[model samples]
Target: MSKNYVLSLYNKMGKLPFGKKLFSLFASNKAPYFKTVSPLITKVVPSECHCLIKKRRKVENHIGTVHVIAIANGLEMAMGFMAEASIPTHLRWIPKGMDLQYTAKAGSDIRCVALLENNQWQVGDLPVEVTAYDENDVVVVKGIIHLWVSEKPKK
Candidate 1:
């Protein structure tokens, strides 16, 4: 069986509308909250998901910097994409929670690099490390995303 959906879609088509569509569908069907990430998850994985938030008035904080929640969303999306690319077909997973620290002022654009090591997700709570980098590649936000992984259900 094929291992990862993003990897399969990315193999047929590079990063673009279709890849984003499939990623959105995966989120839409499973967890609607992840749909918030559709526009930001521009790249495919197991390559790091380069999530971005434009410097729009809507996303800015009172100080005119990127809002903390926006960073959180992108960081979460990055971690999710990495998980989809790394997890085996025999396993099922869902994010359990996250612990984040905002270390710097985020820029107009943010990049998140989150990856799971081989065999990292067994059959329980797995804490995956995620960090969002500012334009300077300095970490603006860092966190551990906990995902509960289990054996896939029998059809």
Candidate 2:
């Protein structure tokens, strides 16, 4: 089977100097809304993706903390990258829903991780676990982003 295009791109570009940043820029351009949080995609491998959102003024709320929605955007972006990297070539996936819990105040940069087990890529309601941690490694948000996976239509 051919490698997934997103994975292939990552494999190629992720090795260059500042490649991850460039790749993240490319991804954000593809899905413009994700640019809102200025997400920096640090890593992408089979079954997992890591992203970072700095606690800048744009992502901060009136309470002097990172906004929950900004964190959600980062989580969603990580989940998308994870799905693109991990799903079988013959299958397709789309986000069906997201359930998040704001556990702690995000006072610093947030690192978001999305994870899926290798065996969890079958056609079904797949739940990708996502968590956001602050600079101190405290859980700021955690959630599941549900994906509806199905076989690709025969062309």
User: Which candidate wins on lDDT?
Assistant: 2
RMSD to true structure for each model, in Å? 3.0, 1.0
Tell me the tens digit of each residue's lDDT in model 2 across 1-155: 88688888987888899898899999999899999999999888889999999999999999999999999999999999988888888899999999999999999999999999664787888898999999999999998999999999999
**Candidate 1, superposed: residue stretches over 4 Å from native:** 15-38
Per residue, candidate 1 scores C-alpha lDDT tens digits across 76-119 of 87777778877878888899889999899986577776767654
Q: How many backbone clashes does candidate 2 have?
A: 0
TM-score list, all predictions = 0.80, 0.96
Error of 2 at 70 (Å): 0.4
List of clashing residue pairs for candidate 1: none
Local error of candidate 2 at residue 13 (angstroms): 1.5
**lDDT values for all models:** 0.72, 0.92
